[model samples]
Target: MLPDPIHILKTVYGYDAFRGRQAEIVRHVMAGNNAFVLMPTGGGKSLCYQIPALARPGMGLVVSPLIALMADQVAALRQAGVRAAALNSDLPGEERRALWRDIRGGTLDLLYVAPETLLKPDVVDRLATVPLSLIAIDEAHCLSQWGHDFRPSYRQLDALVARFPDTPRMALTATADTPTRAEILAHLNIAESDAFIADFDRPNIRYAIQEKDNPRAQLKRFLMDHEGESGIVYCLSKRRTEETAAWLCAQGYDALAYHGGMDKAAREANQARFQHGEAIIMVATIAFGMGIDKPDVRFVAHIDLPGSIEAYYQETGRAGRDGLPADALMLYGMEDIALRTRFIEESEAPDQRKRMERQKLDSLLGLTETAGCRRQALLSYFGDRCQPCGNCDTCAEPPHLFDGTIAAQKALSCIYRTGERFGQAYVVDVLVGAEDERIASFGHDRLSTYGIGKEHDKRTWRAILRQLIALRLVDVDLSGHGGLSIAEDGRDFLRDKATLMLRVPAAPRPARGKLAHRQASTALPEADRDLFQALREKRMEIARLQNVPPYVIFHDRTLIELAAARPASRADMAAVAGVGEAKLTRYGPAFLAVIAEHGKGLRA
Candidate 1:
């Protein structure tokens, strides 16, 4: 009744093998068993369902969340020679009617519909008449009540399970924590035995977090290695987004601002341009990146701290969807932490909700201040484990670790003697023996704790305070004036029940070399750099002709393979990975010609 999954993958999609749990998920779904999948963005999550869709007997119905994402995915699937169609509100009436005809005629291998569309009674009535081999729900995290992209339409999808009890169902997402994963399974009635949680590691993404210092200058330094590349810069507020975009534009970068407050038409146009153009940077709020299907985004930088690790993972994951090396950088400061703490305490969000939000914020703060592997801490939040990744800033250039036992006690003593009602600045000033008016007026200068920390500079003292806050030794009270109060844990440290080891606030490490991840794409010899650039230019030229993302034509990994292997002809190109019959037939000659001109000593 169907072709083999491996056969469809190679012959249609051009990939030779499945990575990690993809093959296993494909097999399970193909056998009509339900599955809940959690894979990172650009980890080939689509293939797990696409391959089975091709192998199954009837159309594979996909419930996607956004109209843009549905269109983007359908376009890419068609480019790979798969029969795909998207039925959404964006389609013209005639086109919708025609697609319905095709669906009823059973001509489509895959049909992508918005959850809103699928939940319509009439639309459901229409789709039920056709045979569906399997159901795939993309961005399944939205189904959860507490998920970042929660939508109520997903709540009604449970009817699909009741309606088609015999049909296999698969829920998929790139970013979902353990709670979200459990919710997805429970909502879809997918047993835990069928849930496949792939390693939450995006090994292609090099993670780095820096304390905010001269943010504009620091952002420029981070952007230096990534010049002329496609990336995103996230700001916390709409005003910041607009200002940063304008500043980047004035600085001669091709940048645009996107936020909910913008005109609807303008927003849609900007989204299209970013999706289609290369080397364009979008400075946006958290609103811009959900379900973005672009594959060639090289980096995602944040100018402020995100609310949670799940939010951070989902936003930064917009980069490197092609499995090529990418970068994730964030600049956060003590002010940001204090502001977030204040908001959590004062906001009208339910007490339980605020508490949970504060807990999530603490987790992200822990990740930001971690002197060890950021990736390991990040993955651990999702109930995954990984070794120290050498790609992160901490693993790349470890900070100076020093025994801060005395420094901790000094800061704590200052908070204690000053009545624990002063802001961190006042406390730090008291420790550093500052003769400020507040210190003189409050007689803090007369205290014995004053001037005890004269050996360390203000910056060092601030680092100690920040680390103390991160370790929960010092709590920043928002409701009772912004002041430092000793947490229960801080009392232990003050009494010598615990020792303090703090990382010195080191000067900023320069961004890693261009070949940072130095994986498949960047591992080429220095001699091959020019050739790779030429290949990329040629790919762009071809993409302009086809009106698709260059990656949709051929991924950067494919070009790197070509540059390394230096294939001499179409026949030779067939040996390279990602060269299926359809793609090679379409793009092989052009890329081969570029390689022939630039590369010598071709691989036989």
Candidate 2:
């Protein structure tokens, strides 16, 4: 008979209870059934598989995508006292042999392998000899071509499934839309009835998006709220990442640049620093953040737009994995939209796929342009819904909306009168009656729509045009000199004389004073703050000695519990959440001593 799952959760993993659907999923998997889990980041997806792996009779095999992710999970599991090991290219010769021996000897509880490594014939033959408890495919969204981060290697996982037909299989991902989920189910042969879809809301994260104006200044203002905290700043280009990192360093911030173009060793070193240190900011392109398991990233800032809502959701979901207050800020403008559209139009995909991409882009634009709650719109894209979350920028300070039909008419008429050949700058100039040579050269000065928009300034006129483009009333001609033209919707609106509402561009707010140090520390009382820092220092010291990320030793959440409860004995510490039998036995004394020291000092 198998051990009880709650026993493993309490003694091996140290969680008081299973979170939403985790208990159900665990029970189902342990019953020798397959499952497809769609949980958000930090939603305890790993625990859903890990607990069952320990409870079941034989070894559990996990298929992971990246080596770093596998290594991180292995380290954390071993620290928690579970017999976990990752079979990857990074292991030394003797270490690999020992792991294989343990696997063949039935001494390993769980093993993580990259898809490439697991697909090898020799490895498959070796694994066929051992009895397997279950198989889990992590980041299962990669199997769907409709997903934002599709991997062809994941499609080939069907071979492994065919080989291990008797093993109960589970597929897991944090990001997948309706179509992506359907495709994943079809590819994995997992029945729809077995899928467990959780709510996609990350209430701990505050969403905010701003129109790109003085991007550097805007980013600086955003950073003021997140001082002395670890975060990621994503840029669209490698040059931008390096430049932004250098600029941040000049401003006295410890920033590092990471991109695919950098030397492999250098990129790895930068990633290592960001993972191990608490205050470093990593300026990177999209190449950096897949499968990162860091739980304390305080913020994720985007200086440019992502291609789709899936990409945005996946990238922004990296922050606040510890379920603490975090921030997601994005600055986008008209150019970002045009560039993304050009990318879709220029891709080699089939027409149907291109149409799907266009629809996805439209959904993302709707998210950015929505006057309602950002979270609500974001969740709605994935076929989820919630009440208006008060944490996003739109909820905090709602934008003013006014009838913009007249303004849109003026802008579209100006484009039409000018032969729809000029870009936004030239078109705006013509609308606001600029005495420029280009307008005169194009004979636009004689047009009736030239001076009709003088009531609004150039900035307002440009804002109106951008809104029109976002509303699909105007189309950007990317094939020719980035010209402006009327879309079918624009023509229909003009013919119908339809009324429209547009948001008033918000003026930039003055940067507020620095807030509290860190969310973790601020949550504790003043008296316990010192103890929390001391505990963090101890965790870092131990982590450095062990050459693992500090979070692997003890998460900030665990430290907060220690500081708050001030457990005086090993038994007391063991009762704390996240303190499994292995951890309590390993580091309980050291932490208890720190608490004792703090207590004595307080008495004095």
Largest TM-score belongs to which candidate? 2
TM-score (all chains, Cα) for each model: 0.92, 0.97
lDDT of each: 0.85, 0.90
Q: In model 1, which residue pairs have backbone atoms overlapping below 3 Å?
A: none
Please identify model 2 stretches exceeding 4 Å from their true place. Answer: 512-518
* Stretches > 4 Å off in candidate 1: 346-352, 416-421, 441-443, 479-481, 491-497, 512-521, 596-604
Q: What's the true lDDT of residue 87 in model 1? A: 92
In terms of lDDT, model 1 sits at 0.85
TM-score, candidate 2, is 0.97
Please write out the lDDT profile of model 1 over residues 1-604, one tens digit for every residue: 5578887777777778889999899998888899888898888888888888888888999999877778788877777777899998879999989999999999999999999889889999988889998999998998987676788999789899988898899899988877778888888999999988888888889988887777888888878877778899999899999999999999889999999999988988888889887789999998898889888899999998887889999999998887778889899877678777887788887887787787888889889888889899999998899888887888887778999888888888889999988887888888888879989998989999999999998878887888888888888877756788898999987676576788889776665543354444456887787888888899889778877767777777778888888898887898788888888888888888888877554443
Task: Tell me how candidate 2 scores on lDDT.
Answer: 0.90
